[model samples]
Target: MKIILNGKEKEVADSTTLQLLLQAMQLHPEMVACELNLNIIKRNKYGSTQLGEGDCVEILQMIGGG
Candidate 1:
């Protein structure tokens, strides 16, 4: 399946969930914010949120600075 990740085209496995995607990319869910199809996805729902073909996904890394 193909999805638009951060404005770029990406090929992912079928039936890939947000959690799986993050793991595949070695990203920490707690350190990033995710949005799917223009809607923000909650952290608790990462395991349940499924990505579809052509879906727009945005992932932004969260940085803490004082």
Candidate 2:
């Protein structure tokens, strides 16, 4: 399936969940915020949020500098 990830088109496996996608991308779930199709998805719901074709996903990671 094809989806828009961070404004870029990408292909992912069928029935992919947000959690799985993050893991595949090697991202730390605790450090990032995810938005699906313009809607913010709760961290706890990542495992249940299924991704579909044409879905728009935005992943923002937190960084700290002092």
Candidate 3:
């Protein structure tokens, strides 16, 4: 299946959960905020939140510095 990830078109497995996707991309769940289809997803729900085809996803990473 295809999904829009951070404004880019990307292919993912069927019934892929947000947590799995982040793991595949080598991203840490605690360091980034995930939005699916314009809705912000809670950290605890990542494992249960399944992504559908053509769904828009945005992953914003947090950077700390001063």
Candidate 4:
């Protein structure tokens, strides 16, 4: 399956949930936000959210420096 991640095209397993994707990328869910195919996925639902083929994922990191 093919999906666009952070504006880059990549191949991923079908029915891949958001939680698994983050883990594979070494990304911590608590430190960033994810937009799944243009929809905002709540933190609580990350574990259940599934990513399908052609899905676009936009991950944004939260900055704390002042």
Query: For each candidate, what TM-score against the reference?
Result: 0.91, 0.92, 0.92, 0.90
Q: Of the candidates numbered 2 and 4, which has the greater TM-score value?
A: 2
Encode model 4's per-residue lDDT on 1-66: one tens digit a residue. Answer: 999999999999998899999999999999989999899999999999988889999999967788
Each model's lDDT comes to 0.95, 0.96, 0.96, 0.93
Please provide, for model 3 over 7-59, each residue's C-alpha lDDT reduced to its tens digit, 9 standing for 90 to 100: 99999999899999999999999999999998999999999999999999999
lDDT of 2 by residue, 1-56 (tens): 99999999999999999999999999989989999999999999999999998999
Best by lDDT: 2
| Best first by lDDT, ranked | 2, 3, 1, 4
lDDT per residue (tens digit) for residues 1-66 in model 1: 999999999999889999999999999999999999999999999999989999999999857788
Regions more than 4 Å wrong, model 1? 63-66
Alpha-carbon shift of residue 1 in model 2 (angstroms): 0.5
Clashes of each: 0, 0, 0, 0
lDDT of 1 at 23: 98
Residue 7 displacement in candidate 1 (angstroms): 0.5
